[model samples]
Target: MAGTSKPAVYKYSRGAQPGTAARTGDWRFLTPNWIYRPSPCRIACPLGSEIPAWLEAVKRERFDEAWRILRRSNPFPAISGAVCFHPCTENCNRGQLDESIAIPELERAVGEWRQKHYRPPAGPPVTRGRVAVIGSGPAGLSCAYYLNRAGIGVTVFERAPVCGGLLALGIPQYRLPRALLSRELEMLKDDGIIFETGVAAGGELPLDRLNEEYDLLFLAVGAQKERPLNIPGAEAAGVISAYEFLRRVNLGETVRLVEPVIVVGGGNAAVDAARVALLQEGITRVSLVYRRTRKEMPATADEVDAAEKEGVQLYFNLSPQALRLEEERPAEILFEQTETAEGKIKVLPAPPRSFACGTLIYALGQQPDWEALGRLSRELTLFAGGDLVSGPSTVPAAIQAGRLAAAGIMERLKRRPGTGEAQFLEGKPVVGFEELNLAALPSAHLTRRLSDPVAEAGRCIGCGTCSSCGLCALYCPDLAVQWRRERYDVNLDYCKGCGLCARECPARALVMKGGWEDAC
Candidate 1:
């Protein structure tokens, strides 16, 4: 014991000592900053919905708050939830781990919740500006909703007897239920948005009257002019465009279909037409012929799968040459076998083959009828969006266009010169899976339409969003991270520029920047 120098006693400083008293933040070239970057799902979403925020609310069982947050950007969540391709799910960071968080299902749950519990708000008085929206498609309705919410007097003119253009006339009831669409439209009406049905913009109501009557005009006349089937006998009595066919079917018109129905093209409309034909009475066989293979199909994989499941036969790499007609109706169709090479379709050298066809529906696509808009004077303030501007796009893209047009109109009304585009996430960096701390997250697989929405929502790791999990504070070796004023704050006086907090952050909300100056 005498020689052992009994355990050297080291006095502990109560607070900072010598070197620790100095601002350690100044000692390093890099600093940790809290910043919000667009998640890959948010970036890929055309409507730009704040998905993580609403998902957080959903997981917490705050359904009302989630619905409110969702409706801020998207007006018709119910409709979009059912019909949107849900590109957000495909780009979800969680998918890199195990499975995507079933975004569309959660979105639909939120939407359906709103539909069940929705109460009409007191109509906001029309106090700002007057806007005339031509067409009642997603774009037109979205523009009208935003404008009305801004206290602008908005009137939607629809050529169809019903208000919803594509929703009512293009998409079948199986995808977007008519009852849901009607309820959503009723809610919009109760909020004081006016809808005038059976009024054609360029036909009955002239563009000149709209320009003179309203402060601004928003045109969302969706792409309605079908691209014709240029083949011989395309004008046969049994041959029809897919748009016309779907429109007639959706409008409750009696559709008489013959057996061995053939639908040409590789898009959603083509698939819809074939499926609809299969459902018709007296129709046993419905075949879909596409010039390209299934991999090259523009239709969503789910729809294609559903078509196959519903007994619609699919024939790929067949290009229709001509329809052989009997009594001015399609009897047999001749096709040229083809192959895709370097993104181009090359006809095979084999002899042309023919298939018996009782009817032919061509879903080649549609174009915007711009004849009336061409006559309007450029002097008038006109904002055009949706399929009218970008032909044959998805519902969410059309909604985005409408939102942008509304913003532009609002700017013009406020006498400010600006493009109508939403600039919030323009320059923000999109967060990738590599930037996330996946090690901190547990692996889980969420199925679509899971009975427990909360459980499904809980799977989301809140990529690129701060959840204030206190991991930063917990992992900081220097005790420099502090939770203050509802957010995490770093005490630069004690922070030594260590990257531990950033590395421990599960949300990728904290990043180490190159300079001591805050880059957030």
Candidate 2:
């Protein structure tokens, strides 16, 4: 009986073989492919900055690399970091988790690192193409920088005694430190970019002469002409536009301010005017009057909050009716109660209220003076950008416009057939928060300003970017994903198309494509 049982016994076993032994991927209908899509923040950014790549570098404390990446898109990170409204943060996917990344602060940090470490190269003179960039604002500076970098001779013309059109003349010292601006300009100068101050393009130098001399011309004169307030006694002696007021103050002119100053409009200019007026000597009260409600105000929330904290009185739903003049100077301003309905302002039937105003500053925005350019403005070779073309846009937008103009100039210079159109995020698919595997990412609370930027940068989830976290390889049922040559590769021989790896990708970098027909 024992001999019979031993003879009948047979061994049977099954074990996992190497992925190379089987072509299991042939059985798959769908295939996982690594695809890069624009992140929501990148799409929202006017400059289209590669936020994830730079943030990754910043996470590793590679400040130089981060700065390099940042400068590729935006030349004035420091200036923009300070003044930018940061629309990028509004669309940040991380905001859905806890808080949006402090992109502005990080950008500023990178800019500061650049200021400390970057040294202009003493290379040979750029003798290739001659370009004259009119105005020294963000757009003009950005165009000049890119053109000069491309080995083109660039000369920037500024009407003001000092460079930086709006940046130097409009923005207050409290918001943007003069030292930082000076350092940036000095760096550009050292890089062989020429700057001619006290030279107006249309006036002294003449735009016709520049068009004849330079190979190409880029005009970024900016919107400096203030929109006049259409009200009774608006031309009173004490009444002035916010642009002119800020310009006078920024230029260090000795202007005496009356006791109580009234600022009209609800934009950043109005807030800046109110805040700046509060800093003046003998100025006790500064009131901001807006025709719309707080929510309808165009100023950034941060700026509004700062204005409130600085003792600036905010009066909403009040429209300026008329100014009472005493001896040809504004003495009291009459405002009528108003409300917005269907995007239109309607004055209430209530009697107009009067506020004592020693000085009335109108912050009704500015417009470009195209007349200043004359016939040169309509020239084919004259490319205009910044506030001149886009009205009063953000600094980052102006920078992007400058970059685009530079590309166009370069294209025309080379006699390229196609128009140098920038590849925008308009048609590209943007990654959403739902596409990410949140379980794989580490949770972090919002830390706006940490002593170490690396810690803050680590909070970035790197949406739409392959972070090489190895989660795809770790979660794969079959050992098809291989690490080779510093990157992840799918073996395909053993992939079953289960989509586990793609589902586990926290960065949403992997996507499943097609069915059996596609694989075949």
Candidate 3:
């Protein structure tokens, strides 16, 4: 009787019964997870640029689409490509293979190419509201761009004769061309963005009046107030702030200086000032002093390298204590030896040393003029960003802050907001160097091109995303893996949960988990 007992059989149907599926583990089967993890370069960007997406588009020879995608996050790609510190390149995964893609140069090339064919998009049809923006710096301009594109009229007021605040007067021509800056600003102007140059927001147009006139207000006055060295002899004849020096030089003013000029601080401004000092007629040498070592300096590595190449003597682990003046003119400076210990500044007991120099240019830092905002009246919806809110930062950071402010304003205006995030993965398992299966990738595709952007994009690791390399299906020992409709599917009838597919995944996008099934 026991040997003759009937064998039970179950037929699967797409019905409501949970335990009546063809495969015993239909609902509780192990799934091969595929996700697009955030690339390190994209994560490093302040503007949240979809770096990999554009890079892929470039690889496919979709230049216009790539340009459009790039512009979605960054408005001034050409300007940014020229001046950005490019932290993205530093975080590039391709560097592990051979050399990091020349992201900045590629961006510059594509950006300039797009600039030749750029046309301002048609303004939004519905008139939602009007807004007032103070300052025409990167932050203000970016804020106005977003607002104007959203069918909101933006009136930008700049105190300078030209619209670009720092881009026009702070950055030198050799680094950022004025013609290029002017041309990019023209795009914003053509978009119906009102630019009122030579008009100070809190001066010609009072804050109270602006509040009453516009429904919303954004203040991005920037850190125009240069922080000065709090030491004696700073008021000497040749002792001047770096901002004033750079501004005057950038405005085409003739600046004549004596030999051996000293520029204090290690930030970007300090490096720029030192380089500018070397260009003066009588300046034979430029000396730059910083409290920290070269590793801890805040300026970009390329800037420091360029300054060194341009004959700027760098003195690190030295802090300026005082300036010495001879007959009311800068002649020497005093410095204190310092070191960073346990993340704290430690000034040693060594005696202060003196160095001889004709002029002193101090660029310690800059502070925003918060008082310029006046009282925050409850009657007005006020917002601020860039250096005004976050202190001194980079141009891309300012642009990102401006975008955030625009979204906040749009929400207040009862309008829908745009997706400010990049098209990348989040919270996925990060593939490490050891986890990568590089043998599946061809060695020829690993070496990228320097001059070719499309070729350069091929070197990307495509972290946490399937590259469809066929390694998973090809290496499946059980013959359970099947490729159908551009995706891999595992036949549970033959699969033994061996996890060979997950191990052989080049992108590390697949993972095997514990699974359960109801056996009838």
Candidate 4:
């Protein structure tokens, strides 16, 4: 062809062009970045609460609005803010850059505002379906909160004279104050959750009576049984179990263990037990013995550090061999040093080493007492202990048992004498916030805010659920997150239980099981 000018060229005004006098296009749009990105903290939450949105409100000093948004998912933000084991902190992208934001503290600050202005929601009508929660621990309380919010009457039966099972009994005062516990209880009571303190459920209350009366029953009994130290002189005096020690402290008992205390185990309880033992000035030497190395220590890093800080000496790669009771003097806590091979620590090897201490605290672990559940033993046998055993192997496992039991009951109801149209309808998430334009989101990366160790109240020693981020309410795109006077509720129908909320969740709350699998 003639005068084709080598197929000519055209250049555009925006991006890379034809190299001639042509127009370029959207160079900025070509930059590949989400216009609106969700905060990692919000995305990691279980409730799927609008993290960035609420934070944006807070950044603008909209205290009222911030609380309003927060309360939509977590009714107990103030309590949870102060106590939730903030899992979101671990997942905060900012942590890689610097310290994550003091999310729990921020939550507490917002919760403080909410506490001042927040009003519990009043219900329209009460349903005949009554839910009886066995123990007044977090799981029980949480279940009660949601059940009550769903308009079901709830009754919490606790064997202890007081409420807040772990919150009241297991946790140290420095961490969870009694007043906060009472206030949270008051909040629940205001929402119509009944508490039968000092009433034993499996014994005096009886599940049969509950089943006969209520539409359904939920058992949230936590494992309180401390692992037994079956060794020579095991029945001797001055030996305290973790459960006993925590219970005594929680119930305000004055126990004085002699100096040279040897606590066994590397878990949080072991640390807590050792530290608490130090409160007894007579207890001078507090050493922890674990068969594992420092890396394998199951206790939270903070707890292990705190134990060391508080003068609780730890001897890793060691296990208690036996307890030698001198009848009156300091008991001997015999231990054997351990070794590792092929990445696994070798315990009870041929000829082991041993150490001696005064008072021996077997913090090996705890188990759940399944004797109470014996009535249903033949029928609905739920293992609190691992492997369908009658008892739970640990306190946390017991709590898990309670939750499983409750979930099972809920699932049974869903299958049997089923949910109404409104019941299933209510399970759907509520829509609130508008869709975010990911393309317009912040150009800056996740802003990590280092958490101040100084909790206005105290430090959280790994207990309970609900990570401080309250992410469950934040990341929920459907806005299904809501809170009633009693507690938090996530509408499952609308939730799809995508578990994006779960996987991203810092604290393993807002659990999702058996879902579409690709929603995340």
Give the top-scoring candidate (TM-score). 2
Q: Candidate 3: which stretches are off by over 4 Å?
A: 1-34, 122-127, 375-378, 419-426, 443-448, 465-505, 509-520
Root-mean-square deviation of Cα positions for candidate 1 versus the true structure, in angstroms: 5.9
Model 1, 1-520: lDDT tens digits are: 6685788788786665566666666666678898877888888899988888788788878899888778767877788889999999999988878788788888888988988998877645565678989899999999888887777889999989998999999998899999999988998888888899998876787767887888888989899988999999998788889999999999999877776899999999999888888878888799999999999999999999999999999999999998889988889999999999988999999888898999899999889977856766676678999999999999999988888888889888883422232335768888888878866654234444478888888887778876555678888988888877656888887878888989988889888988767634
The better candidate by TM-score, 3 or 4, is 3
252 in model 4: Cα distance from truth in Å? 0.4
RMSD in Å for all candidates: 5.9, 5.1, 8.3, 13.0
Superposed Cα deviation of residue 195, candidate 4 (Å): 0.6
Which 10-residue window of candidate 2 scores lowest in summed lDDT?
415-424
Given candidate 4, what's the lDDT at residue 73? 50
Model 4 TM-score, 2 decimals = 0.67
Q: Rank the candidates by lDDT, best first.
A: 1, 2, 3, 4
Total clashing pairs in model 4: 50
| Weakest ten-residue segment in model 1 by summed lDDT | 415-424
- What lDDT score goes with residue 111 in model 1? 87
After TM-score superposition, the amount by which residue 226's alpha carbon in candidate 4 deviates from its true location, in angstroms, is 1.7
Rate residue 182 of model 2 by lDDT. 87
lDDT for residue 54 in candidate 4, whole number 0-100: 52
TM-score, one value per model: 0.87, 0.88, 0.82, 0.67
Which residue segments of model 2 deviate by more than 4 Å? 1-31, 375-380, 415-423, 443-449, 468-470, 473-498, 514-520
Backbone clashes in model 3, listed as residue pairs: none
Error of 3 at 358 (Å): 1.8
